[model samples]
Target: MSLPSADADWWRNAVVYQVYPRSFADSDGDGIGDLDGVRAHVDHLARLGVDAVWLSPFYPSALADGGYDIDDHRDVAPELGDLAAFDAMTAALHEHGIRVIVDIVPNHTSDRHRWFRAALAAEPGSDERDRYVFRQGRGADGSEPPTDWESDFGGPAWTRLDDGWWYLHLFAPEQPDLNWDRRDVRDDYLETLAFWADRGVDGFRVDVANLLVKDLTEPLPDRAELATRTDGNHAYEDRDAVHEVYAEWRTLFDSYDPPRMAVAEAWVPAHRRARYASPESLGQAFNFDLLTAPWDAETWRRVIEENLDLAAESGSTSTWVLSNHDVIRHPSRYGITAAAGQPNEIGYIPAFGVDPEITVDTALGATRARAATLLMLALPGSAYLYQGEELGLFEVVEIDADKRQDPTFFRTGGERLGRDGCRVPLPWTSAPPSYGFSPEPAAAPPHLPQPAWFADLSLERETDDPTSSLSLYVAALALRRERAAGEGLTWVPAGPGVVHVVRPGGWHCLTNFGPEPVALPEGEVLLASGPLADGLVPADRTVWFREA
Candidate 1:
């Protein structure tokens, strides 16, 4: 194996790609993606110029919550691959000059996990049960749930056991919340970190990083009361105690050669997000405010500036994300026109895709999505790209209800369409069967159904088309690697509905969000998201240039 690079701050301006294992590729023709599949596709990432790949949960699980309900923190899922397969995949990615960042679920574990199973069989107040949040009934006859806390997926957070006790689960009932207060729980995670680091894993993407250390004190405060407190003392999300856990993680990360890094998946406000990414804590925290914002100049500008400023307060660079496995793809999100002449908060809304009033202009959405990618890549810090986004894939909103696997789908009784649409398997070739996703074209269907429309958006179709979304990403990423290396970002004055920023390396980026074409600034164009109209940047386009 090669030695680690000397540039320890490689994550600062890096562009990372998120790989949803089950949807990326299937090597064994089992119709499910595996580690061998990922290894086979390292060229795609290397070609796209991503510095690293942040793999979503591939640990042993029942898929109750789409692999987030991890049954074993230190091993890979059998369907995906074993530890040897994981090592081979890591080595392959490293050979292609890409770092590896795997998801670490610290907050919860699957109900089938050894610890959870042991806890279920143990007495109520035993050490086994103490490892998780187990509470008593609230009302007479012990029939009522412990508290009224709601699951993030939907319904109630507490599940009543047959023994008259209840267990807390902030998400699906199959994933029990871990009690971070327990010494064994904390120690086990520390060991988990070492296990991966020893196997050449470069970093970790901590799942639900802020929700780990909950304030599960008695006379449990209601969500309203918890929301009203700014004291950093909360029931579940973003409690101050979470930082202490990250601090411990940071020390562990620093122990590795060249020092491994971590980016937190915390859904807190801009201010608290900085703390999660503080130097003493995890090195970076995802800034997802841009993912939900409408395609408006003012809104995008405000979120960018606020994130940059707040991240600076904690001496950390901001991390920008447009879409992930959990949300609808940006192409579809941007396609929908709001009813009241106002831009809709796409991913943040409840029951996002199932609304009958929602209408998506696919063409317009793809255009805006490309423009957004350029803008995000031009920013001062790191950026994350979801898999298949380079192909400009849209959400497969027409999946049959019976085929959905997301916990949110069943938990909400299909009221919320959930994230299955976005999690559909990616298309590599335009042809039939599994669309080159699996080795056997006649193999069983993918874990989640893929739409027939994917033929047009397959990598094979766009691989050689210079104007295609995949090519745009390849060219933009190449330029970004050279031009965006510096940290400087100076905003240039532009007309209404336009964003212009100058980088330190003579690089200038401008994005036009208005309805009309705008005159290009005096410069030699390096790259453009789409074709320029008569030397003018068209609406919903982004351009990068150097002063002529």
Candidate 2:
């Protein structure tokens, strides 16, 4: 496959800001975000110094699995505006020098999709029906899922369709898994990519990408066996055939000028992540180790080193994230406590006589968070910034039971509440009534409650405040871009929780995820985050040391 010109190192060292359109901005006063709303925010992203914006799925669907379950690959959902709005958004983003990456879910489609509907209607042997994987004879009894593999969201991976055949759904039943084994399925996705690319769309952030292919030979353990041995569901990620599917996609993407990129949502080990980006596969894959790693120095360092090493070997770019739409915020993960001396962890409230509000003594300070942010931005790869992370926005608090929407909560039997808390709308202004997100008055007819913390911490305010998280992110991006840090670089080990390396310009990057401060003999502090007031001493922070 051909590569883009060396001069276009945009994907490397580029900052990608993820926009969850449903909650980012609402232009039509519909209380839900739309393409027009995203169009209006393009300038804001440019102002934030991000190189591009990765939009979540806005495709037509039943909204059962958020937008991941696509019913139509070509049409935009009516609630999110029409195809015209998408074109306008893309053009507007391009004008701002910011690229647009749309989310593509190839593993599955909504049960309501025409293909699935036709498959359901057709007899078992129909050629049109082969577009999906439908299997019979589960076992001697035929009463359980095909395998003991657990779904990422929970529950059995297979669902019995009305036709009495079992269809696999690694996520939700409504989100029926696509039959990648079929040539038609692959061709359809290629055409979908071409359609968007032809429309000037830059690239794609593929959703649940690693599950495109699965092993059909293994039968799921019986329900009783699964219940006793492990979680009774499907393990659909990181399967062997995923590489082939990705290679196919990469080949198609290469045909386009500038080599439109593809980033996979691969929740796998660092090494597996590397394999997914094996040059011939995806351009890059999101690194979740950082997000999942414990909030300790050694864990962080090891994760970073593993990622760097894997990326280097795979000939792929490194990517990192501290938070995303589907998980808890980073602050909460780090154990937010009042005694730690920081703001209250966004996820937890101060329960009287229980857990009090976190103060500077108990909370993770701005410096620590900033340090992590800087390290993520300065790393030798593309970076993904989740919506509202710039302002150190915390996850939504006090979610009412009725308001909770994540399917995981149901599937996991409430063991995990799902990602609804993180998917709440972005609070642009704290004025009142939907926190400046919805246009309606606070106590008006719609009567939507405003996100209080959003008003307290917003891009508008953070942009003005030098100490604000938003400002810190901007500074970090500026430094990364200035150094041309995206160019040829190698990741070398610097002990656990540390990524040590030299860039093409003879600049050394020493980042420590360890709790204890690390003293670098030489190099200026490009950016510091954590409790270090002077930005010199490292605390619970990440700092880049370039030779002075």
Candidate 3:
């Protein structure tokens, strides 16, 4: 086999595709996606010009939180495949010069996990119970949860046991939070990372990187208390102790022949997240400010400036992301906004809370979505692409309540719709019986039902049409690889709602976010998110020009 790249610095300005494994491809016709499915589909990523693929949580799990509640870190999910499948998939990806980044759930594990199960069966103060966060109830009869800290998925963060003790779960009850302060817990994850690294995996995408180190000296603090402590201290998030864990991880990452790397899903504030990305820490973190910025040139320009600056200060490359497995697709999110300049805080909000008031204009959303892709890809940093955004897929908000499985939906008593919309199996073909995600029509229906309307956005349709969203993504990614790999960006003066960016290789990207068309620059039209007419870029369009 060919040796891994000697440089080992591939993430700098690289395009990494995020594949929700269950929805990517089904090679076994088992109605669920597996590692062989990824091996079969690496060609799509190669053709799309991505440098790597990040698989989201393919480890053994009960699918309690869609595989995020990992039951086994060293083995693949039974429905997915075995360890041999993972090694084969990694080998195939490396064969095509594409790196493999597996997801690591460090904050918690499924209640069914061996450690958690053993913790439950052991005495309250036993060594096994120290692996996770367990506490006695607060009430006289030990009936109340220890804290009022709510789960990000919904409901209380603490699960009460029949034996008068309670377990802490920052997410769903099925996902019990682990106590990182315990030496065994830290050693366990370190060993898990080494296991994947030894198996030839390139890197990892750490889940909830900010929430690892909790302040166990005090009782669980409420959100009100969490907001007041600003002395560079937090109850569980952005704690100084978290960096100690990453320092250990960094040492392990650097020991590889090619020196592996990791990017943290660290969701600290925009201006102050550099510490988590120090060279001794994770070395990279997701800058989500741009993902939530208003669809205006000024707003986007500022977000881009701050993110790149922060990355530079921390000695790390900026990582840009738009959508992932946890939230609504950007095309749908942009379409529901009323106007270009409207400010929206679009995080992971539930559908049941907002569908009654919001209506999405699919055409408008797709137009802006393509323009945004061009803008993000042209920026001077690494970029992340969710699986279906290339096909211009919208959120599937019409799943029947009985079919919904996200822990958030049930935890909130149906007050929230959860993340099922984003997790629906991808449509590979325009036909029925699991689209082409399954190999045959007779296969069991996909684990989560796919919407029939997904046909229009199927890969078959997108692949056939040259002007489809897939074409734009392929063309833009190729251009980004060929032209926009500089370490800095120079902004030229343009009118309001226009961002004029000049990269290192004399390529210019002009985007018009206002209500009217703008005159194109004096250069050859290399690629445009939409068709150029009369040397003018239409409103909500982006065009890249090769300078003479």
Candidate 4:
């Protein structure tokens, strides 16, 4: 079947796959994945039928925050490969009709970046220091942080230097927030966009896109004070000034041949999200409400409706995502419930399953995850698939504490288990140890440990198994490309715990979220996430059909 074309608005309903570079495949046997590794796996992506590949950061980094702390935005990391390797990989993906979207860390730069190093050496208020958000301490002895804002990871956002100066880092201490007010910082980023666009990159995935321009005008509000305010403005996050930066970027992106595209990883409020994807700003913005929603029918329907409505407001298509590098795998996340009848906030759950009040039902989670996939893929807009989720890989909850590397784990003093479990290396073959993740069988272990049960879900084992999650995804994506037509859906009134919606082309999708079978609509079954019983959609299953 022919896939979608790379037209000006190709991303409208595209299925983009995310590759976490370090865990995808290690071509050099260095226990870390590189661009060469990605090049070798192009065929796998082609066979899986993705429209584009959204690559995670592979830029020069100390891996301080798992490559998010980039020292140079223009060059590839020596460990990952050089500019030449990156070009080759990009060419390889395009050869298979897959566009490439690379991550752009415009919000911050690594502390070791040339600009940050210069800022450290230069005296306070110097031009070099102006590239970053550096300020004098506020306390009597200049000992306290300029603001009481807490880092997204943990602790204070400001890291104090020996000179009693402070710099803001919304994430780890190694990643210093850039001063977007500076003309040089903005111009340099524009040049970075041109650099990659010149190198055949199709688009960019803007990291922390909403946090670039902070409102640190004066008297920065503390966390406590901001909590009580009714206004949506903040000292750092989702400020209005950030949209100006993206407007400049939209202009630059429009200059390209096919007109490059971008998706904002903005964690702003639902009302503010569409602003990032406005016609004058970035082309798209991620909607993560579905990722954290519970596996309930009412909640799922509400989130989908809200996302579609918001996207419509901005003249943009909705973006649906189930899992990513930072969060727990959906299969594992679907396994739990709250004892107090409160909704299970999937975002806060730790990797190790350390919360005694919560318990996991593996079988139930897997079933729901498959059902959720059909629901997401059948929706009216774009979708993103995280690596290894095709094989239905569960979170590796038992990694040795010593092997843990997420700074959140350290910053929180192990109270929070962090995201290492979901970042474990992919298993390509049904083998022990490295599991074909490394080119060499005896290559050193993957940076993160893979559970032994991974053998059953390896690509080699699931490639031809029609019942496997990988096979389900392959079939779903193929069918979606051909038959997932229409702009909106009409809700078909159904019994409790059952959701039935019909799309534009007489397409009918029914999902049974309850614990019993439900009557199916009168149509030809095109696909079912799991086996149906007596022509009824089984519990925890989803099915798509159409008029015969």
Q: Rank order by TM-score, top first?
A: 1, 4, 3, 2
Off by over 4 Å in 1: 1-3, 341-353
Clashes of each: 0, 35, 0, 0
Better of 2 and 3 by TM-score: 3
How well is each residue in 405-456 modelled by candidate 2, as lDDT tens digits? 6777677666566677678877776565666676764222111233566677
| RMSD each, Å | 1.4, 5.0, 1.9, 2.1
Q: Estimate each model's TM-score.
A: 0.98, 0.85, 0.96, 0.97
| C-alpha lDDT values of all predictions | 0.88, 0.71, 0.85, 0.88
lDDT string, candidate 4, 452-519, tens digits: 89999999999989899999999999999998776687888888898888888888888899888888
Q: What global local distance difference test value does model 1 have?
A: 0.88
Query: In model 2, where do residues sit more than 4 Å from their true spots?
Result: 1-7, 137-144, 218-236, 336-362, 365-367, 441-450, 486-526, 530-538, 543-548
Q: Backbone clash tally for model 1?
A: 0
Instruction: Compose the digit string of candidate 3's lDDT tens values, residues 1-548.
Output: 22366758788778999999888888888888888998998888888888989999988888888999988888988888898888888889888888888899999999999999898889888999898888987879888888888999888889987777899898889999999988989998999999999888888899999898888665667689888876358888788788899999999999988778799998788655898778898888888876677688888988888888898899988988888888778887787753343344454454433555566778998899899889888888789988988888887888887988888788887777777888788888898878889888545888788877888889898897989999999999988878875587899899999999899878899999969999898998899999889978999999999886
Over the full model, what C-alpha lDDT does candidate 3 score relative to the true structure?
A: 0.85
What's the residue-level lDDT of 424 in candidate 1?
91
Which model, 1 or 3, shows the larger TM-score?
Answer: 1
